[model samples]
Target chain A: MDNSQLFFDFAPIWQARTLLLEGFGIAMFSAVAGIFFAILLGLIVALMRLSRYRALRAIAFTYTQLFRGVPLYVLVLWIYFGLVYAVGIDIPRIPSGIIALALLNSGYLSETFRSGILAVEKGQREAGEALGLRPWQVSRFIVLPQAGRIVVPPTGNQFVDAIKDSAILSIIGVPELMKVAQEQANMYYRPFEFYTVAGLLYLIAVIIVSKGISKLEQRLARFSRASKEASSGERRPSEVGG
Target chain B: MSETLLQLRNVGKRFGDHVVLKDINLDIAKGEVVCVIGPSGSGKSTLLRCINFIAPPEEGEVIFEGRTWKRFHSAFNFIANRKYEAKLPTLRAEIGMVFQHFNVFPHMTAIENVVLGLTKVRGNTRNVAREIAERSLRQVGLGDKLDQYPEKLSGGQKQRVAIARALALNPKVMLFDEVTSALDPELVTGILDEMRRLASDGMTMVVVTHEMNFAFQVATRIVFMDAGRIVTIGTPEEIRNTTEPRARAFLSSILG
Candidate 1:
């Protein structure tokens, strides 16, 4: 009994191009949309957490802690399975998946943003004040620009995180990449081939997103010429796209 | 004496258990440089901060123009005026401040730094703000370095840019907080020269400085503080004569 019947193939996936492409589209869509919402929510939560009002700080803290502590799968399930049916409202699974991932990412990214805001030096704030900038203006014009450069790497990681986490929403019946892979594997009884294909697709997507983010960071990093002298990671212009 | 431009009446401030400033009353007139000199922890900087309403003195009032600056709230937050914090940009625009460490915005060019307050707070057009910034930068002898970032500047040049930043606002009263303390001894003269030029131009200024010679030459009146109080307020000649023990001690300690 030489049970050596296991084999790998990419031909089947290629034949199922339309299905794979549609699933890829959904995955990409959710990642992009989720990140937009996450950054927006993170900005709001960060500001609230930094506010002088105790109640606001408490509320922001609760949102950050509760969501961050909960697993991404649990939050997605709670929103798609528990909240939707409980409210007796018929919502689409695609949007529900994006919302869950965004809400969860916001909780995580807000902490990143808060740390970034803190990274700004005390002198910069005072500089804005002495110039007579309003408090909000100082935060908007000076601190946020400085904080943004600091938070770039973390935020790029979060974007990829959201993209990968979007796959988990397939349990709630979202037709994302993982959903397509699971069905294809079951129908063809080739789990290895289907899963590996899905994984590689995600890797490619992440590489593109990561490279784009690094370029943006490079532009932002150029603003602080002083920091560059001390910063360890210096990108030579010739190294770009090499 | 000329017209009174700014008056601090019975101003007092404290930090937790320590009294940083108390019963600090001073009058500033137009075209006068009022230099506040004292030993460390003498509250000269704190008093300058209170003048710009940075700390919002816990006690007493600041009468500037026709408006009065007093405590709007009791909170210890960094916001200058709690109730009018929104409007403070306008008030602060009228009264500019230069810090000891030259707090120029590192992210912006020298010209951009100079014009930020004008465009952002004063609502001036971009072209108008740039023109004013360029002119002010020229006045500070940084006309050619307007495009340089703060990190590219020397201590003297950075402080000059900071001064230009404040000067662009055309403030009624300029507050200088140890602007030369952080510069090299050689760099100190450039900023002192700028201050002297400003003084001769009839700009009302309140300067908290450790530069005794600068105070002697430029200040119309000298205020010597110790232990969080103004020990003596007199002309440069009077401070030079040294009647008050605290002033004499501080002057001798610093001058020598």
Candidate 2:
């Protein structure tokens, strides 16, 4: 198509903005739902892997391996087609796709969380115990807070991945951003305009989310520094006298 | 004489085929300050860890507060082998430990670290915990550093804060594992001074230290370990004047 025609035809994106808005809304809803479940599942699996019980660790290991080994497309297809068709379950396509994404994302996120927990120095655990804290309390307060700092950057990356991966739900006819673009392209017979617009929208979303995460990281770092300064303030007078 | 607070009976630990500690039988009286001095790999730290049940002994028993020793089993092995097991958390409100590396929670402020045990483990109100934490920090001369994170503190400051964190729990016994070893030479005295104050306060303590001066000045008794066993246990004067060649050699070497 000619550049002028492409530009004019793409004007329909603004005119039919409600459709685009609806698509964006659906993608966001699915991404948020998927991430919430993914985090919850990831935390459980991570804890299971760290458990002192051999069977519990083995079970968690198997779950991560099985889900992470398969491609996202296969998982989505299996959930939408295989499970829904074979079991004759009446679950909607959107919910099914969300479950699949959450399940898949959790496997990878679990490993991230596990590594973060492990990265914390062993001495911290000992210190917690020395303070008479129970093992569970140690994990909840000392270990997890430190681990959260180490895990956030990677977890933020996974969240970005989750948002992008929501596009895969389009295959199940959930009418996400990519699917909307696809339908528009097919109807207008202008693949270049619609697909480019869709790609830009995705880029914008990712950029905004990533910037927000960076801001959060900076704020946390500053908070930590301020606390340190306040503590050091006590020693300054003593150091000068000495 | 103080009452016996902790007893180690035929305590032994092995990692696979390598024995780390063996045939350790000792009793520590309450309010006694004992210093353990030994070469690296002599298991001085391991023995300290065993007191708090940080490391379980493979054989024998540990008695605390005159109670009989209890056996704990591993859950992982039981799940794999289909045998029921018992896992116990042996940490009591009585025992507190500090490591050589000053393992303060990097994410928490100094006051928060000190208050964590009081509020979370002891079930104290937040205000009460904070009050106790501040008092402990003041005792350690860290009164102004209530909100500082570990990474921002110097080695000596961090170690002092760790001591306060332990003291905030109101532990009856405190264990120190070479706490000053990681400090800069100039900073070492600050931490040692704080420890000396703790010792003077009649806080029950077992300290593993390389600083001979600190041990000589502060320890009520000094126990020397070598090759995973206690070679000598005596007062500083006894250790200094002993005719035993090993004791003389160790003392001279450390002093030199």
Tens digits of per-residue lDDT for model 1 on A121-212? 66678778877888888998888988888899999999999888888988988888999999988877778888998999999999999999
Q: Which stretches of candidate 2 lie over 4 Å from their true place?
A: A1-8, A222-242, B72-91
Question: Chain A: TM-score in each candidate?
Answer: 0.89, 0.87
The lDDT of model 2 is 0.80
Model 2 lDDT, residue B168, Cα: 81
Write candidate 2's Cα lDDT for B30-72 as tens digits.
8888999877778898888877777767777878887665444
DockQ-based class of model 1: acceptable
Clash-forming residue pairs, model 2:
A231-B145
- Could you list the iRMS of every candidate? 12.7, 9.2
- Evaluate model 1: give its TM-score: 0.92
Give per-residue CA lDDT, model 2, range A1-242, as digits (tens). 66455444667567656777688889888988998899899999999999988999999999999889988899988988897679877668899879988999899999999998887766778778777777888899988887777677788888899889999999989988889988987877777777888888888888998998888788678444533443344243321110
For every candidate, the chain B TM-score is 0.94, 0.91
**lDDT score for candidate 1 against the true structure:** 0.84
